[model samples]
Target: MSTIDIIGLDGYENAYPRELSGGMRQRVGFARALAVEPEILCMDEPFSALDVLTAENLRSELLRLWQAGDVPTTAVLIVTHGIEEAVSLADRVVILGGDPGHVRTTLPINLPHPRNRKSALFQQITDLVYTILSEKDYEVSPDDIAVLNQGMYATFQPAPASDSFQQAASLSQRKPKSSRSEPFEAFETARPTNLDISEEWAPNQDSPLRYPQLPAVRIGSVTGLLSFIAEDDVDLYVLGQRLQLDVDDLYPLIEAANILGLIELNEGDARISAKGQRFVGASIDERKHMIRIAALSAPEARLVAQIYRLLSQAAKQELPEDLIFDTILLKHFSPLKARKQLDIAIEWGRYAELFGYEAPTGTLFLDRGDEPAE
Candidate 1:
């Protein structure tokens, strides 16, 4: 008599045979077979009596145990009637033909775990196997033959939208390098001649411009103001220098925020609006999501910043200066468009007073504190 427990059933030793369900009785038979610590375990339609879900569960449990290396180094072989179940559970599938059950074909499945039935490769293999089975010289009804023929082409194809990543990458790579270069010239020409400290900094109350939607500038400005308010008005020039943006780019964002009742901008200094303060209080993920949504909605420097944020997040770090060109290419934007977008973000930063250039190292920093007007 077998002494080993099946499916962790050692505690049920005294249970009456009549009390167990068919599945439990099947498990008992399995336990008895395992008792002698056989070097090999063969399951011959052991799951046939169980429901589909129970059979699948048992198959998974068996595979897990086999992988755990706890059971005495035993090789397992399972026989099943369902083709999908056979494919799922077997390392190799063997089909029998002829009246005496002679082996007709053997197929090796080398797919990795967590296989997707909907993949092209899975369908291909299933079709190939069905074709092999259909070639046997047995008489079959026309309906059965038609069903087998359809199984040969059963496959899933994803919608066109699923190809965005590839399309985006291809589009970015094809853009000319010269298109990206002209924007920097525009930025260089746009820098302020005299730092106008006395200009009445009324909040630009206009609805954000639609086309040439430049949201990054606004976001940078708001970020700068938030940093400034959080750190105490430090130095204006230092803040500008830190954010690597021109004053022009910085001003509009702050102005936009003021329009939206999100911040207060005054004489080269900015403080958060009540809404802005609440925005800052949101979780980091929420803030990023909001920034992305807002950037998508309007023409502001924030859009450019959102793109940079996406690239940075995807790359898992700040992009190197030299690689920025290549990164733009990967985004599917023409080099010109990418350069325009990036320059827009940088310029907007400068305008919003969120960024400034370091004369010594030339590195941009997120200058939160206020700087005295240069």
Candidate 2:
């Protein structure tokens, strides 16, 4: 009767786990926990999977038990990503920070019991928690991200440029050019005409030979983010906080936008640029043109262009995807990383309409529909 009163699972006690809905199963689990009569109950993401109404009801019932001193547990500790949920339930919220993750801060929620979500005090505390979580000291340096076209999986780093001629001579002697064929030769020779080989290889540049991990987000997401920012001037950290985006989810989008000159980040504030504004206003076709123009600066774009040129020159407009996968990407990256990089390249290329990929046929080709910009 006590369990049924708390969880409200009256007639469905006999229902198996497989037969019950997710919420019903969750309620059953809670009832089981209460049945254990433990002194302390610790829940990790307790309501994360439930429907909004069900989660709210469960929270209310738990609070009822905690306030009335009905449960065996004198204390309840919940680990949750939801800021609002924490503010609603916890008397004190302790946040963990850093790479290894340590105690950052413990915040006390002073709001009265049965907190009203719409109240200004609740909002204020929620915002405070967000500010604390998104502390500016944790910001990622743009330079810390690696450069593209560099070999991430290389066994040895190249020595100083003074040793380059000697290294090349030794390499030439050690391995004859005749032994390398097809894909390897093609990939090596596919360097863009406009690419500055000397500049890329210059030893003066810091970490020039490191591979860049591309943004995990798609072009639509990039555009959507820009449009979202264009509506208002926002601090990057605060914006991320409101959206519940962590460093990993938010930083890459910022980096990608920064690289394309679409958004400017100044002291953690993100504002859409003139180019970004134009992009937001443009039609689908014109936006593709913009993506092409901005993306030209990337090494991946140049490499794709080079490949397209080679294939066109050979009167072979289409090439098997496996050829490039094995020769170029796999040489520098692990199979997983290579696939990720290839997907990035594909996204960029398709946005620019520089190339088309047919997954069914496992082929890549220059898209004839994408004519030169006027």
The prediction achieving the highest TM-score against the true structure is 2
What does candidate 1's lDDT look like per residue over 1-374, in tens digits? 22333243332343456534454466677677776678989888877886433343345445544554545646887777666666555667787887887987667665443334545555665666676677885444555345444434544332121111111112122332222242222222232223221122212337453323333332323432453342234344565665555677555555555543455556766555444443443322223333433332333333344433333343343334335445333344566676555555544333333333232332333322321123
lDDT of 2: 0.58
Among these predicted structures, which one has the highest lDDT? 2
Give the lowest summed-lDDT range of ten residues in model 2: 160-169
**Residue 175 of candidate 2: its Cα lDDT?**
35
Model 1 shows how many backbone clashes?
47
lDDT (Cα atoms) of all candidates against the true structure: 0.45, 0.58
Per-prediction TM-score to the true structure, in the order listed = 0.35, 0.44
Write down the lDDT that model 1 would get. Answer: 0.45
TM-score of 1: 0.35
Which portions of model 1 show Cα errors greater than 4 Å? 1-6, 137-374
Predicted candidate 2 versus true structure: per-residue lDDT over 215-315, tens digit per residue: 75555456546633632457888767755678888887788777666787878788876566555444334456666655555543444444455445445
Estimate the Cα RMSD of every predicted model relative to the unseen true structure: 25.7, 24.2
